[model samples]
Target chain A: MTIEHSILGVIASRPCTGYDIKTEFEHEGAGMVWGVSFGSVYPKLKSMEEQGLIQNYRTETKGRMKKMYELTPKGWEALHKWLGELPSYPSIKDELLLKLSMWDRGRPEDRQTLIYHMKNRKEQSQELLDYYLQWPQNGHSSISEFGMLGIQYVQERLETELRWIEKAILQLEGEPQPPVQDPYDLIPKQQERRNLAINPPVITVHPESSTDEDRV
Target chain B: MTIEHSILGVIASRPCTGYDIKTEFEHEGAGMVWGVSFGSVYPKLKSMEEQGLIQNYRTETKGRMKKMYELTPKGWEALHKWLGELPSYPSIKDELLLKLSMWDRGRPEDRQTLIYHMKNRKEQSQELLDYYLQWPQNGHSSISEFGMLGIQYVQERLETELRWIEKAILQLEGEPQPPVQDPYDLIPKQQERRNLAINPPVITVHPESSTDEDRV
Candidate 1:
């Protein structure tokens, strides 16, 4: 539904062919916030046109007939309504965190696998942060100051996440204790595997030792 | 697909009813990472059962029969495969950032609404952080040390976001300039709002205006 509103917003700004809207989403500043794949965009445009929120006309360019879409008054009203509403908190489906929750159940080799993936994530974050820092000056002349600020917000988030991952690696290696201390010392300490954060540690602990804990 | 894998992982740990799986998602540590609504869970369970990844048995309870599900060996193999694969970075669809991107297009009243919402978000973050801090000790005795680590990770993220939003509010109010400096002084200055941050009163004359050049 938000995607529909976003498409309406784009159409309200300017009448364009569906291809133009796709390109705008893929290449324009809007892409930075929400991405609409061509797979979803065409169907959305067709449905919206059928719903009377948008209207289309054919234009001939270089002897090619292209269907251009624009927002009707209804579309304008909808876009305005959406723009005025308070946004909901984004729902996150973080798989890494899910894996982390089950880390204790995994074998030592599985923990090594997890650490390897965390390193990959860290590298990706570094690359994204570097790219964002060097952006706006790199041919993105049309990105407004506000858009740049939004990008900076994302960069800051990435940096924070990278720091958290670094700490998570340390936790996985058993170097840093859990961030919150257990006052009762109920958490049983396991035999530490040799620094998996730096190198693949050997599995010395018996697998049966892990099964002693009751499953949630 | 990730949800299916998550369900598999949960079943692999223990044979339980679909209701148990739903509860594990809603009330357990996994809830902090990924959420699976009851609506999606039952269907996924049925599909996975058809795929032979999981099998279910009926157990007579005090008065009624309860369906319990457990992972097949095939399901165990699939879980291991998923655990080994490099996890993809979580995709965020932050509507607040989207709205911020178009901040200039909004009316003054809309800007106020946005600011109000940011404050609300800050309050929510603070509350969540406080809750995370007090968790595990608050009758969450079954939470493993690894689970506590995940909670701490989420807490740190929320704190970082709160800080970012504070800075964002200041930025939106036109008190602080963009984090990056303008190299060529090409950015046009708007009327300074108020000195929300310290070290103010440096209202230098515009370079082009001082040079008696044409203002675009």
Candidate 2:
């Protein structure tokens, strides 16, 4: 979906200035799911206004003229139309995964570069995870219950990925194992797979992770 | 990175026709990781040839002309440069998550609509997971060790998400709750968080999942 929908969604909740929208993106859960730049926000806002999806009014806040954008009837109509449609598959594009897929093609020194990158990636996820863990303590103000769900989902995903990266780093550091197994080649029917998916095994975190206490 | 890099990378390994690359995307792990349309592949190939990263020539097979694309030295240089740069964070845009985040704003019936969509999504992932599970039996031919790694990663992620959806469905089905806890708000530093990440919890799939025997 276009950023216009997100912009319209935000305006639907509450009208805000451009800077408010930009800051909301950086610090909010929606921004985590959809990446947008500070530069793209204004151009999109202008275009949204041009399309009559949103309208802006001038406001004086602290001696500065600010343009506040709010959803028009057309914008509300557009958002409802989008919300009625089925969500498409999640669009995932990660350079790290792409680079890792092409691992064998790079030079030996490039391996070192990759390890360094994962280490950095590990650090960032950890930082974010820790910050998310703080939400329970911080008084919930602006976030809706669904927003809280989104935060928890991010925390769980980050926890899983952090562990995956550790395994990947070890695999890269040592001789990678090749897949070897005798044929057991037959996929189950749709109903059977659903039964299997619904009754999944217990979820656990790393033994040493800070959130190990939350392990189920 | 552009699909140009992926095309260049594929051609770097060996020259192939546009149809070959297009088919590779449809059936390969790379395609699952990066979604591209059949329509997109030809236009990208044309632009890459114009930009001098790839060169194409006609070859007649079964009285049909096929344009074969091969990477130029400049293409190799470009691919290497991209590989050298630090990988960026993964870009994710999921309509499901966006719709779910706006759950409070949607009509009550939208909840049922969402669960239906997630069920379809689950079915698709199950189908793909079952397909990947067949890789061991099929004599590994075109896939490298890293490709196998990508497959396993995909399988693991799909497994985790499937379970998450189960909980989410139940949560959606039941009463929605609010957050309430005494504050203990503090984010850890870089070093401590890294140690926590490395020692993450064990991942387990549902008991009913077809891949139960493989769960570790």
Candidate 3:
């Protein structure tokens, strides 16, 4: 549905053929700002025409026959309604957090893995930040006013993400305790060996072992 | 695959029955921190057992025979590999951003919608922020040290999102101009009528009308 509305916006901006619509979404202001993909365009164009939201006509240019699409009155009304629709909560599925939740805190190697992923994610966000700074100035026209608003928001988000990564790294590096029962004891053979041993390092290494909350 | 690893993590935390695994995912620290769900757990458990990643034993607890699952040597090896795997870039598909990029800049109604959606998103992020600040204190135990790192990251993200909303609103309210070609002209009858008019409001309404970039 957003794809249709974006197409309508491009058409509303100018009467363009299907190929022209693809180019705009692939190369123009909306493409970079909205993350609109071109894969869904043709099928959506067909359905939108069938639904009477848009209409197209055949035109010949440069020895090619092109179907140029534009919004019908119905399309304009739909685009207007879509532009006003309330947005929903953005779904969050951060893999780093997901993996970190199950982490083996006693393992030094696991801590290193945690830092590796944080840096990887930060690098990717940094690349996006770099692109945002250097785009539009390259060749194509500047993004529209509303598009600028979206870009600016993304810019802040990536910056906050980078800053948060730094703070989290410092916290992890400074931390010194593993907070749960070591899963190694869940193995029966290991559990039996530990139980048979006289005073063990579980008591030796765990200075906070007397706390009730750490037991479960 | 992530589901499998998370289940492995839970089993590694403690040797637990299938039902226990479900409960932990539904009501424990891992659920909140990782967004793990129970829907796919049973099937993944079945496949994991077949693949030598886990083993289960029948236990009679309070007259109910339950299948308790535990990690194999192979399972521990898999969990280690997963925790070390370099994380990929998080997928971002923000609906508000996708819509904002296609906005009808000439319509006051459209501007209101943009502000409305921005505020709506901010309010939701604020609710998450309130939760981040208030949670764990309400419950069984404070999140593990690493879990604290993930929560702190989310806390900062939501705050940045809220602040970005304010800045975007200011930019939108302070500025004007419908950039690119207005889709209105694509309507043939409207285009013809607009062309026929001696002096039009496109000239009157568009103050940045003379800027070459504004012409699209």
Best by DockQ: 3
Candidates' C-alpha lDDT? 0.66, 0.66, 0.65
Q: For candidate 2, what is the DockQ?
A: 0.15
Error of 3 at B163 (Å): 1.4
Which ranges of candidate 3 are over 4 A from the true structure?
A: A1-41, A56-69, A105-108, A136-139, A170-216, B1-72, B105-108, B139-142, B170-216
Q: Alpha carbon lDDT of residue A38, candidate 3?
A: 54
lDDT of 2 by residue, B183-216 (tens): 3211112223223333444465854544546546
Kindly report which residue pairs in candidate 1 clash with one another. Answer: none
What TM-score against the true fold does each predicted structure earn? 0.73, 0.74, 0.68
Cα deviation of A105, candidate 1, in Å: 2.5
Worst-scoring 10-residue span by lDDT in model 2 chain B? B182-191
Candidate 1 vs candidate 2, TM-score winner: 2
Per-residue C-alpha lDDT of model 3 across residues B132-210, encoded as one tens digit per residue: 7766365443356676667777778778878888888877677565443323333334334223332232453666556
Per-residue C-alpha lDDT of model 1 across residues B58-85, encoded as one tens digit per residue: 9988988999986665776677677778
Stretches of candidate 2 above 4 Å error? A50-52, A108-110, A176-216, B29-31, B38-40, B50-52, B108-110, B179-216
How many angstroms is residue A201 displaced in model 1 relative to the true structure, after the best TM-score fit?
29
Clashes of each: 0, 12, 1
Query: Across residues A1-216, which tens digit of lDDT does each residue of candidate 1 receive?
Result: 678866775664456888887777654543245567889999999999899888899999999999998666566556556667778766666777777665544433445677788899889878777777777666533344566667877777788888888987876776434424444443332212112222333464877755535343
